[model samples]
Target: MSSEHTPPPRQQPTFLTAVAALEAVVADLDDEGFGPALGLVGGLFGSADPSEAAAAGPRLAALLPDAPPFPRAHLAMVVGACVEQGADPVACSGPVLAGLRGALTGAQRLVEGWERTGGGPLPDPEQDDPAEAHERIADPAVLDAWHAHLAVVAWWTLHLWQRAAWAVYAHPAVRTEARGSGVTAALLGLIRRYRGEQHDLKGLAHLAGMLDDEPLLVLDRPTGTGYLLRMSGLSDTFQLHTLLADVLIGGGHLPGVPQDPQVVALARTEFLDGRRVIATGAFNLVAPDGSWLWNEGTPSDIPVVDGVRTLVLDPLPYERSWSAGRFIQEIPGDLRLERVLSPAEAARLLATTAPARSAQQAFGAGQA
Candidate 1:
């Protein structure tokens, strides 16, 4: 006689069960794979009619993770389902939009915490003024907070771009609608704010670098000040400079040192003739003792020197400013025809230009 065999019984899929299923898919993939998955899910759900998909929102939402390693695909699916089910995109937009907004808010809290903790690394006793200690703490803290804020804002902006691209691809009319939503203006404003924040962060980093006894709190490596300078004066060039200006002009940070005369001369020249130098590509300035300050570059070069402060500036046509006016206007000086960097310098500059983080990382994956 043959033994009787029984199959496993089917179980109903609860919201939690659905969420876990989506989360499992997310967990199995690396950072780079997340975007493709999200796109696939969006496409699948987006293809369906709004009424049918909206009915699936609850089930899709249930399948989503409540916290880290957010199931971006499931999120797209939920939105798609909502759209399919005839839920108003505006209404369906709430949860996903709220999540993004909340992420931004959380980033704000991190910044505030960093600010409350006195911003950068510790302060040096030699450089610290007893009278201004409190103000110094608060100022740098605020600036640091702003830096974090800018990063999150940039992340959100990129995210919106990706989502909008997907939506517009599905319904081309959305592209035209988006253009008129004042989004361009809002992005411009954010970019302006980012530039201002970058400037302040550079100054703070410089101040931190100057404190010889205290180690600087670098958000990244090198333990020195970094500058992000934009340059747009002469047409046909785009110059963006990131310089690491240390406390001791020539040498790294060291104790009880006389100011380098050459460095001082360089600074003065840069301050006085930088604009002309950037515009015309040539400049000669006399130091206090009458020594000449000279740094030459053609239009095609990146102005970076190994031993000296690095200045990166690009120049484009004057008319290009209409689209990137904020970026252009913020440039410290006009673009010149001189080459700033040699082949070696150019190689070094390229090495420093790292790719930006993908959308997945910006949304908190891999973050502690």
Candidate 2:
């Protein structure tokens, strides 16, 4: 036995093995394991090159012609993977985007089917196991939720393609190796705008769903302050330490405060005099404007002109209503200011908030 046993057919390299595994997942797309299989494929080849995507594209495309609408949307995403991986933008973008649009149309059809059938409540993946939830898409509400989620995914893929196309022609912002291009910055702005529009739509949908609705007041906080104080109900926390980080501080897309100029000046005076900034009426109070005050030795009262409202920052420490210590205490021991998060990590936070809100609506229906 010690004589010349062929060394176990030399195991494939890790990258090769990964490629095989991803190809297998793509091959299995039509099977019962479609959900997990799609996820596996994404994990394996999401960042892989066009060559890798090309290897699996045939198998992925095999199922798409007859695939269900939701699954079809997933296939579109897989197609995006190939495009993102160094494909010729002009030749490929048109076909790829066309395919994605078709997927979106299919998704819309699925939603229509749900509405026609009067489908059931949305499934919570956290609350329900995969096996139980896999085949439960008959419900309209559930389908709507899925539609929203999928739309976000598909649009994100498109956004990425736009970025990749932009990168080809655009110059880098920094000459250093890891520097971002102007394309990336532009994409960020587009993403911010898209996210804001989506968020405002969701907020409107949520608000409309409420039984006793009140007027909406959008507030923007002043920028350039060393710190932002966030108040939701009686609790206050520094913006950096908030659960969603800077999102709560600077992620407003709606119009600003609409108070009279005279009222804003008076508010500024009260703010300067160290009056507590409290919500008197029903308002969607948001963060302050950047660079409005914070300089010139006095904090500017966030302007509330038209419908835009800015945060009123007090330059004087003794005159301020919120204490730094109080805000500091609200932060958890585990929270860190400077931490790099993977997409997966950042997504987990969003995963909780959206589902929780959905669950509230789902369960609250019985109470009514």
Candidate 3:
């Protein structure tokens, strides 16, 4: 309820969302609320307009004084993020850099009174509040290791997300036990790829949107580093980060076979980076009424991919979440559609009173 808050750019679609997220954490924060600002850091990193993003530098700078290295380290990083997002470098520049320059000149050590002022649960980079990672430490060496690593965080441009993962692992104090803690293992995967190593495949979450749904694709088969997410890899998008959730997923579909090396090579093209490359997955969409029907020529996990029918996984409830490849796929995997449906289940839940093929004169293909 503070009057001094920097007003959000109302033109941006997520303005209300940003306010809500901030309010959820600390409702009574005034303009200078450092904790509230950090909780809203996601909004800052995700600013869509260049002019809006330009304000991030000084905004984040305001928090450095009241924060630990966790946030002080973020001071320089905010500028780097704005640069990557295409904000005008000089316009986005602010007095924050002077403070950033001065802070780094000191030798790294645990803050003078972290034990008295610290010790909390570790935060989940994806789901929890970013400022909640502060907690006191009994292990001075590990705390010192965390202190040194966090204090030195720079742009880390290509994978800015590593900064957060590194922050969490840097604190083994088990602080801010929010939820979801795969960040450390995920980071090691980055290290492995940096060394030119191989990783096994798992399902990856394929994110989507309204008809113009799902972002684009990137094939990450690399000589120097490995892929970010595998097509047949892990389906959970949090394998990246929340920032990644909005930025990386959903590249429009390009048809290919997973077993063919040529198709796989095509998938690795630079065009698909930070986007999804298709491999026989159905992006079946349904109406708000829970009707899983689509007219021909609409793109995505096509209900019919090259003659094979797709099984729309859990589409009885129409929504965007089920539109990803993981939810819709070529018929036959671990899931099977049952012929047996109770009259109520089909008529009400499935939105069909009877099977009418193609609604031919009101008797087309549908529930029987």
Candidate 4:
């Protein structure tokens, strides 16, 4: 067909019409309607006709006024469309961004104010304490709403980052603007937060191991520690594996392994002293039965040492354990010491560590 004669795709529904359609779909919980709504929104903004989009902008802005916004999947489709049309995503949503920032600031201030008033302790179901009843009168629902709002906000922010990264990866203009405006740092921050909250090591590993760019790794080290015990160097392989283990262990998703002799041997030498065993570098252990124990936790059934702090196997990998709330809430109160590796140091080590040789290379060198 001749280019001029070929019919153009059907024009997208008007912006207000699309928003109404979306609200209807959500009200009916119509999964099928969602796709069409998204496509329509994308088409409206993504189209070459700026006048059409300009006319729709105010209506769309009015419909999306919340902070840490919602219906992010739909918003992302719209943003993607704007990006495709060679329009600035920020410019298209300038009013919405201002509203969002204001909403977020207000929400944060409310949370801070609540926290300042000592927002009362979590209920002690065991005691049914009289004080707990008094605390409940202070509108616990407000706290719940605040937390839910924050979670939604966090999710939308991540969606924005993901869309931005997708745009940068595909659009040269996006790449230029992103690089100029410190969008990379924002993207990384979102990725880090997502990884921490969602236990998504694979996603993080993919981003961290991107071949096109040097990954940013932050390191923290303890002073007055023995030099030999301090961690150094960065290895992508190690970092990826460490993060994988952390996510798995923290989520309680590790698989069981049969007892092996090599595990016993390593346990004897590496963990014999009963001091918290920390992995200074990544290493594979072979059980006596010739089975591999690539990533495993310390024996869980063993009784914790009395008066001993944490027994951190790799502090950097489990830095989340060091958070004040985590330490107070998750760790046993009696544990004498907290064993946490510096996540910063671990990340640094991972960045600097030499690439591991392939199995073939090791065998060829007679070092397997």
Candidate 5:
């Protein structure tokens, strides 16, 4: 589980099968318009040529307002598939674009509204038994709403669109836009909301970090908030660790935190032959005040301390999408950094904690 910037390749979304599952809905619906609705939208998302998608785009957009509550979630996937396939932007730049933006926007709106009623965990499942937990969950209508929304593809798409090849749509070239309508903002807005819910916001930093060019939506300028560094062009753990370690040592400008953060390493420690040894591995930044920053989005927290927030940006697969700018506070949760130590720190730590058994090796005077 190295937090090294090893980005898996840029795989395209599974476009064809993504919406084919929705075909099941056609059989269950009663309204006559529903069948045609499924057909029109379905064909556009099918393995049609880009020209075909372009022609069909406007028709689908016009039909949406009266389309018998067509699943916006499904529509979003279909549209994303279209983008993945290189659909002409003109078809989307019209009302079709409006529909595309609204798909993710609707999820955003839903989550934001949920935020307003209150902000805290639902009833503790551990404290309550299975039956009692169910009662507590069902008691809050908000929980019901949340579960319902999550049962669909919208939330998953929101979480995983970064893996999509067509995420290039996050930025609009002049060729892809209308006179005033926003074309690329669905992906753009997604970047901005990176600070939101844990469920909805997962994998976002990875996306922002790996982007060759993620507009730095939230972390661009200096403010009272600390900077969220871009991972653009950075390749491996070695480079990332070197840059970040230097930042910590130099008292770099992460405002609202103590100056001169300490770099702590989580070396892979093990007992060997009645002696302790540590394999060179994870590293992190720690302030005197226990403020920590490691950008590794592991399921576990830093073993060192609580409330350690990390904003690691992994370099992109290639120069392409934009990296979002962010303040440390704007990042969603307490995350970890690349589980790596800089060479200098690693050497110092090994010397201090687990020096070689022989003096010659320790002093670098051993036989070649």
Candidate 6:
């Protein structure tokens, strides 16, 4: 008789299939268990597109045994090997995008459920330390693949939000509708909630130390939160408010505990409770801090309707509002930077923001 105990068949995952299987397992797990599992499993898909990751739900369910293994750098290396075998990262992105969308949606729902029932203290999965992740994930090619995959997801998240904002504001009729409605309060709520989620998701994604660019929604200046609010007050446009609300509630961006007092105060006071009106002929570049970037020779109400036309009057020479003025000056057209969101873009963006896949099946397995 053979004396040795037979080792179970090696769970040799291929690049084409690894990510999908892993994300499927992640989808099945509950909030408490998902974090740890994700650290172990997510690395398999560092360069996969969302759809492939999304599709692997069933396979992951079938493949992952209870008491799954700790993150093995070797699994990622399998992905690297496949790349060497001629797998194109860009071509593979379609499925990876689908997978990410599924993951994000599930994450968002988990947060909503927790909030609904007041789940006791939030859960944090221990991400592998950089040194550890690198040590375990020994192959440079594998690491590069992983970083590239994450970069695409992060970039898409920010780009989608920016594009969505532009789409809502570009419609004159849409802008006309919300100019004086109760939409300001609604818009405030949406912005507050989305920003809350972005705060968490962005940090989580950044923890890997792979992303090199700054977040599109910069909280420091008058542009990010301030600009959103100012426009919320000036337009009170319901379509815009609804668009933002859908992204926050439906988009799978991670949720973080909100920390900024100024942001909170402004959302509550200015957007939720402040005045809402449509400017008839006024065009002003307001800072994120709620200060006006005055055109050099014009008063705040001089009807500088054309943003680019007003650039020549920028107060950059005065250095009073250099950042805001410079931002305006950089625009190629006569339109204000804020005017970039057009209806066609909004329509295209709407399709992208649609829920890519449902979590109903994925969450069914429940903490395996």
Angstrom error at residue 226, model 3: 48
lDDT of 2 at 154: 40
lDDT of 3 at 278: 39
Task: Give the per-residue lDDT digits (tens) of candidate 6, residues 2-76.
Answer: 798888998855534544545555567543554454455555565655555444433332332332222222222
Sort by TM-score, best first: what order? 5, 4, 2, 1, 6, 3
Estimate TM-scores for all models: 0.25, 0.27, 0.23, 0.30, 0.33, 0.24
lDDT (10s digit) by residue, model 5, range 119-181: 454322135333432233332645564443332223334433332223323333422342134
Q: Pick the candidate with the highest TM-score.
A: 5
For 244-356, candidate 1 gives per-residue lDDT tens digits of 12222223431223333333223322333333222122112112122222222112122224433233222211212111111212113231122223445455554453333
42 in model 5: Cα distance from truth in Å? Answer: 3.4
Instruction: Evaluate model 1: give its lDDT.
Output: 0.33
* TM-score, model 2 to reference: 0.27
Give me the displacement of residue 132 in model 6, in angstroms.
27
- Residue by residue across 1-368, what tens digits does model 2's lDDT show? 47775566765334235545545654655455556555666666745656766555445544444444445555545654554454333333333334434433433443344345465543332354433333333345556556544533343333333332232222111111111223223322333334222112222111111111111122222221221232221112221122222232223321233333322233222222443333212121223322222111111123443442223221222221221211212112111123233445434322322111232442364355
- Give RMSD to native, each candidate: 22.0, 18.2, 21.7, 19.0, 19.7, 21.6
- The CA lDDT at 237 in model 4 is 30
lDDT of the structure predicted as candidate 6: 0.30
What lDDT would each prediction earn against the true structure? 0.33, 0.33, 0.30, 0.35, 0.36, 0.30
Weakest 10 consecutive residues, lDDT, candidate 6? 327-336
Q: 136-214, model 3: which lDDT tens digit per residue?
A: 3224655654543442332111123233222221221211121124322332343333311111212111211111212
Which stretches in model 2 have alpha-carbon errors above 4 Å? Answer: 1-6, 13-75, 90-106, 109-368
Model 5 CA lDDT for position 328: 21
Q: What's model 5's overall lDDT? A: 0.36
Cα miss at 251, model 2 (Å)? 33
Residue 247 shift from truth in candidate 6, angstroms = 36
